[model samples]
Target: MKKHWSVFLTTFMSLLLASPVAFAASPAPQVNAGDTAWVLISAALVFIMTPGLGFFYGGMVRSKNVLATIMHSFFIVGMISVEWIILGYSMAFGDDSAGLIPGVIGSLSKIGLAGTAGQIVSGTSIPELAFVIFQCMFAVITPALITGAFAERVRFKAYALFTLLWSIFIYNPMAHMVWGGGKLFALGALDFAGGLVIHILSGVSGLTLCLLIGKRRGYGKLPILPHHLPMTVLGAALLWFGWFGFNAGSALGANELAANAFVTTQAAAAMATVSWVVCEWLHNGKPTILGAASGCVAGLVAITPAAGFVAPIPAVIIGLVGGAICYFAVAVLKAKCGYDDSLDAFGVHGIGGTWGAIATGLWASTAVNPAGVNGLFYGNGGLLVAQIISIIVAYLLGGIGSFVLFKIVNAITTFRADEEEETSGIDIVEHGERAYSQSIMTGESLGLPNEFNKMN
Candidate 1:
């Protein structure tokens, strides 16, 4: 009996000692000021991407509506900011009130961002406020992205209303479903950034609005190449810089994973650019700088969903495919579909996002990130299946949701301006400003709407 008791005691002591060692060897919970600071800076970086998007879209539009186009993004930033703080964050991340949608609309009250400081997120040491600010940038840009669809037309009054409603109904719910500690987040779906919530949703919604609003004045008759490629290139450069924050910031830290995400983001963007140039050169006999810029953006969108999951090598593969696929999607598919996307938002963001979702399922390896599941390449078929389901659900829901919302807006306000208003230019007719008064101007000022400014 004495010998047996001694043996049991020794085993218990050994188990106690080994347990802590095992836990220590697991993913470290260590935190430092540097990582936290990097995340805060990263949050700011993502915020700048919206203005960059504004400039890129503004430059491609006709000179008549340059300022108006830029205003679309700018106004969205302001409008969404107020809405996000008031109701958007609660709808997304507020506690699961009923387990139905998680967070009641009125539970957190309007603009009541109290008790958010010093509160840690479930898995990390970063404060909840850090996550809130990081996510606010996403809410700011998603709706702004849709402005490209109805560019050169649409009344600003109706546009503002549409932007507000869309953010509340569409963007917020999707963000909650995907990342707000809800059903989709628990379903093993992989979306490191806003590929589904931001890019895919915006792209599909833009396509829907364009379809409902009808084509622009010229339709298929006139050539409308970019008004200023140089401006577009500059905008693209800004987006490239801002994307490091967009992708890496999703990690919410300045650790090895953030570094990995940063490197992968750069590698994919480079590879996608090259792939686009090659494909364009082969098909059109020469690659333009415009194509290079488009390719870079396409690569950036494609890699967003997979940035934190896959390793560097697969990221390169994803980029190469992204360039080739998005080029065909824009140049060939849009032409065949006859849908006036106006800016290829669907082609680049939608198609590229789909590719990234699938590639993530194929390339994710647990060796690099044990917290994340391994993909098919790493002998896990279940994760690949889950990824496919996520893509299907996101596309169907986003596409159908936008269509319904646009239909309702169409019933209330005329989606398109009259023919004369469209032809004369939306900037002068809708807004009391002309983007270029020197080149072509009537005797009257834009706001007066006198006989000289009247449409012929």
Candidate 2:
């Protein structure tokens, strides 16, 4: 009996000693519950921004086209959400070594979220799944941002097709370059959140598409005013609320960096709001609610790149300058260029994001985030150079890629609505639905002449 017990103990010890060697190649992931919770919650917050964007763009279009405009955002939420799960995530985040174009995009190893059950995100204590969903929200919102540029006049089928392709070809590649260890990441560019990845790419692509799609009917000849100011204000509020999650969540941990991002985001937004109102009041003789909302959004866009790398004081300056510059872009540059960017997507986001990226190079400091390097103000001009190069790269990718996609989608389906469809309203023409039933009963749904329909 004693000899048998000794044999059992010896066997158990041998198996335990051999287990480490067998599993040495792949260590277990260490996930922090708090970090995982924060990332997931932040992802949910970002998800709200898409529908919030729908309301924002929806309120700015003519009543007849309200539902169609909102549908652009709503449908993208569904389409891109599915695309992310299937291929977008893999293309943006899979192993670069196995990628179709190494260092330019990710491989398909993570297709359908395979091999992600217990993996931890690199450099973080959260599950890879959490990171995946967070990035998915970003993918969903980016193309939705473009709809505002060509509001009220695009064909639904063309928009759908264009969005899907853009996500795969344009968005995925750019995201990989900036955040997924691609070219820009290797070049030492610093985009704390998504100045280059999300805002610049989306804004530039919006400009390109709007140019290709041409202006809305009677764009220069007639007035095109927002139908609901209150709704626009509401949407703006939601965007501001969600932005905290957008910027702070990039830290990927519940730590000091997240707190710094939160503070800077508020500071920049408030200062930009004040600056925009002041500028508008001086230029136009009265401060408008639209200007205030737009200013706040501009500030948000500008601070996004610098949120985790700069101090609050620098953030305020970034917002102030961003608000003023974006206002000029929307009020002066677009008017001078004579190209219709329907809701000022290019003016606000394009210009704001540009300024934000530059500001990051000017004000970034390692004191704020040890992982980040110093910027120009901190005696490192190389960071600024890297930022500029990244900006130029983003512009080329967004502009050229979007132009090609626009032509492709247009060939497959007519991209623009006909004159009759434009005159009657795209909502009924495209979706066979109206936003407000009262308009249908009152014959207002036909977009007949009304007090609000004054010509420009």
Candidate 3:
């Protein structure tokens, strides 16, 4: 009996030793340093997009709330960064214990990313830290995008609480469903860069929040002209540059897939920008640079879901459709619907995301992405049906979840600044600072009458 046991143990050890050699004999993955470096840079580039968002949102609002709007984007970088490190990553990516929520809150208990360096997840050569950092950038920008809808009115305290709650309840769960080992990923939903999970969800949440908060006082009556159109333009340029990373980096490797995503992103943005401008020129009698930029962003948002799955032509079509649809949504639906999306977050991101998701179902093809499914145009109508379901589910869930969370937050602290404080402007009243202090000081220093103060 002892001899038989020894023989079995010896055979098991021999098999284990031989298996690795057999596997090594198969084709090995070519680890390209240039590709790795490019992806790393791309990840950092995406992280830069949050600040670009801050500037874009900052310049679009009246100067009164410029800093306040920027702060919301800035705060997202800090708030969600910590959340991602603590519970967020675990909830999304950890072992699927119950096949629902990720098994343990402390599954990633090694806080401060202890021992994360040099660690490798199976099937990939990249360090686990690289994946963590890449995903962290996604978490940072998503809530920042929502700030556009509630730009001028929401109190800082309420804003902070809402973002915290959102990171926990909305962003984390949707991320798990769409990207992590959850039912949605299991069901074969294709989201290359978070069109449904981030853009649509945040867009719906933004719309709901703005509705609940009501319009800014004297919204229609007030001119509320953007204080710095040039700044907004520059910000848009930055967004365009940053988006290459946002879409391409999702491929996680600098391979043909990444190159395809890059081209698709550019084509979509260009087509959408042109389509939006043409539509606006026809309807509004002229196309403003603001409209052009907005159209580009709408296209970017729309193409995000289909970036990896669709070819360049379909990407362009998707962008054009997104631009046309989002333009109308911002121009027509907003006023008639009586929702005051302060910076058009709902009109652009929400509507664009919905269109993009549907477009993915329409344009997806196995030629560009073998792992992805073919869409309706490729004779797969079921994919389109699934996309529609995804859209409805995302909007309803995100809208309701955000509303409830805001209510809870509002109950704890006043959600809006008092009328007196709001009238005074958040920079002075809330932050005890002004955005153009130097300009104000210079104006005061000059004996001549201050045109800026008079304009204000």
Candidate 4:
């Protein structure tokens, strides 16, 4: 493990420090105004999911850490945006390399976006800039998704560092393999959006961290109720709204495929929401807002890989199963297993994403988008097998890579909040601010903006 870590660090450092002069810059391609406009809109929409994710996770944690919990997602947006600009974009989407490792991990020839502005991505009308910005939104959300696993117990500094390193180590490689035309691309693996890349990588990382960090100070004994379900519901709505852009934008064109992805996204989410509510009602004898919200997100995650390959009918099946399976994972599996995933990141995203990728194998149809292949149901078992291979590769790489990085980050930074801070609350102690206050109306001890404030 140590040797492997050293090797990975050495390789990553080389890419990090590589000069941008290695590869000859290609002339800029003519970008379609309509495609550029659509991609821009999609990128903006996907970016909003981070805040929505913040609200969703925030509402699930104790009120004392509301601001801190929300801040994880909020802060990562700015932090990973910078990291992406630094070397992430280049490492994931740079020109193809002859080196075996570089093919799997991308070359740094395009590092720092040097010589990439007006260039058009090969075979697409969208500007390379639009593609870069769109992919940046993905990098931003992947680490934020992991925050759910260790919420209320993580040091903000450590989490931020993990985001930076994880983007380089785990997230970037997966992005390259699946979408950046790396090894998996050569193997004919399909991830129309990010079933294997974003959701699975984040999910595996979340589960690993939950196990490594152990349960929160209080395990199953404490009742960590959600502070606000409405906020979570609203967040769910925003994720649904943003996901259309996430799925359709993968088409990278303003064409029929994008239209199909748009409708399928809506169909899957709607059905999944309904199915989740129904499943919860059957299991617990009452349907909760949280269940419905989770189901909606689960459906979105599951359909993501197949959005362009499957029609509305198949999408409905995918969403329904996604909701039911995720419900089981969250409601039954997590409790039975006794791991405290504070916000069910692994349950919904990890499980849903894995299933979605497999389902794409079963339901993918070349008819929906000619660029894609037919699935098992559509007379091709090969695509399904390819999807499974991609899933396995993603699981091993994402899970193991994340575990090593977490240990390293912990060794250096201690990674988690101290017991006292975790108990007292991160919002007040870590951020020096409260989510709620009474300064204008009642000034006293714990008054105004500071927890240290005292009336004289």
**What would the TM-scores of all predictions be?**
0.87, 0.92, 0.89, 0.89
For candidate 2, give the lDDT: 0.90
**How many times do residue backbones clash in model 3?**
0
CA-lDDT, candidates in order: 0.80, 0.90, 0.83, 0.87
Off by over 4 Å in 3: 1-32, 98-115, 437-456
> Per-residue lDDT tens digits of candidate 3, residues 39-109?
67877888888888989889898777788888888878988999988778766665555534452122344
lDDT of 4 by residue, 1-456 (tens): 999999999999888767454455665577799998999999999999999999999888877788999999999899899989988988888755743376577778777899897788888998888999999999998889989988888888888888889998889878988888898888888899999999988998899999998888765654567877899998899999999989999999899999999999999898999999999999999988998899999999999999999999999999999999999999999989999998999999999999999999999888898888999998999998999999999889878988899888898888877777887778877899877653432224334443222110
Evaluate residue 25 in candidate 1 and report its C-alpha lDDT on the 0 to 100 scale.
81
* Candidate 4 wrongly placed segments (more than 4 Å): 1-29, 98-100, 438-456
Worst 10 residues of 4 by lDDT: 447-456
For candidate 4, what's the RMSD? 13.6
| Residue 170 error, candidate 4, Å | 0.6
For lDDT, candidate 3 versus 4, the one ahead is: 4
Q: List runs of model 2 lying over 4 Å from the truth.
A: 1-29, 438-456
Error of 1 at 131 (Å): 1.2
Which candidate achieves the best TM-score against the true structure? 2
Cα lDDT tens digits, model 1, 1-456, are: 999999999999999989988887857454456767887898788888888887888778776677778888888878898898877887777665443456312234324566676677778867777788888888998888888877887888778878888888878777777787665666887788887778788887888788878777665666555666787888789899999999998888888888888988998999999999999999999999989998999999989988988899899999999999999998898889888887778888888888888888898877766778899998999888888887777777667877887777778887677878776767778777876653353435445444323321
252-340 per-residue lDDT for model 2 (tens digits): 98999999999999999999999999999999999999999999999999999999999999999999999999999998899999999
lDDT of 2 at 1: 100
